[model samples]
Target: MTDIDLNQILTFVKVVDSGSFTKAAEQLKQPKSRISRRLAALEKALGTQLIYRTTRQMQLTETGKDYYQRCAPLIQDLENANNAMTSHSVELSGVLRLTAPEDYAKMILAPLLEEFLKKHPKIKIELVLSGAYLDLVKESIDVAIRIGTLKDASMKSKRLSSISSIVVASPGFLEKNPAITKPEHLEQVPCLNFNVGQKNRWRLVKDKQDIRIKANGSVEANSPELLYHFALYGRGASLIPEFLCRDALQSGKLVHILKGWTSGAIPVHLLTPAQKDIPAKTKAFMEFASARL
Candidate 1:
């Protein structure tokens, strides 16, 4: 009935997801007593017991389960529509929080973000650069730039670009090492490990042949960026992103090796938390980065 409050229904869903009113209060920054009152009121309005409760744990009744499934998506659709309308009328002016890889944050996003911010002077940006995975919803991140495949199908993602990696060494390292005529020659040459991946192994595919090398070197580093510097210093051959190492490869600072081979292209995505409607800034930035990347 119209007397059944929509906010109570939303709070009910959150309570179910958070497992208890106590946890839901913490997540929503609301009072547990208030949540209990609302839930009781919603049940009274519906004239049915929606949940089976004890001091220890709670379970959803058949009516509650059915009601939740039906109302949750309807609430989301309503929220999305409301957000879309509200955001369209206002100029974007707020903080936009984002997380991305260190290499990308420095080499790629930095410049693009500068231009984007200039165009929207009222907007502010907070960026976190790391290789570690973060919870977008828990951390309240506006957007994230993730490499390779995505795991969360619930969150909205936009494919920006494909990042392909290449194996390269400094001109000096190659000159000092063997002729490197084939992929097998890499074993003779020192191959620095990138981020301890695959434990001294390099996977390359070419000619429909899958080549897995027991690759090792004098140095193991945490980032491809670090290994890039090591390779520049003529330490060892390393695999680095092709787009990132473009300048170094062009100026002969780094020379491409193992012709007709690659570690393969990884799909990069712009990710945002699952929302009925995405925020204005997040949508704008995703479009901006997609156009440039």
Candidate 2:
């Protein structure tokens, strides 16, 4: 029996996972020719054709499927062991991919990331900011910061903090429009609606009493940051995160309205994929963010 090359096996697994040699080569930081050569060498050593490749697509053979099913887990275990071993002896260094809401990333995470990077200079970060919940495995995201209820039970989550929502308007807008003395008064004024998850309605709570008001407005947007700006410009009253409006409220640029009523506290969570072993870099960021956020 010929002594098999572990590198060839690793290359084979990479090719299968990536679905093409070109992609696998790019990920491995090797030439396409080298990836092909490795796959050919691996097949020769095994005495079987593992992959059926063409111009458009690549498919695994019967033996290849069985081999991959067995090999993938073993490869993961080896990589995990290597990561675990190296993490203790050396500084954490790897590209950590993270995703979060755009506004939150800019206002909250930007500074924290700067600090995190300063602490771990060797680590590189790839941030994907979007309002949509991206699939972790498909997007290859290492960690995600999310606000509100988590629907996916498959992912592991760590509760960071609870963010309370504030209903606010600018001093100028309040002077020109109807004064909001209670929750019912909100309907009479122009409300800057944040159209995400929920309808054009604002939910307010005060001491066990829950009130739902149908919000009518001239401006509606999916971004809370935009709404915050609109509120500052005295466009309309906006229901936004308190953190986003705290400075404006203090400076008197924005006035907190319906003081006793709140939109309720939304839970913030750090999410990671469900796996046997979490990479040290991902774990480090999660812990770092958990304490600070």
Question: Clashing pairs in model 1?
Answer: none
lDDT of 2 by residue, 1-293 (tens): 35578888899999998889999999899999999999899899899999998988899999999989998999988997787787767898989999999988988999999999999999999999987889999999999998889989999999998888889999999999987998899888899999985588889998899989998888899999999999988899989999898888889899998887888989989999998679899978987998898
Give lDDT: candidate 2, residue 6.
Answer: 88
Cα RMSD to the true fold for all candidates: 5.9, 8.0
Regions of model 2 farther than 4 Å from truth: 1-88
Compute the lDDT for candidate 2.
0.91
What number of clashing residue pairs does each candidate have, in the order they appear?
0, 0
- TM, every model: 0.71, 0.71
- Which segments of candidate 1 are over 4 A away from where they belong? 1-89
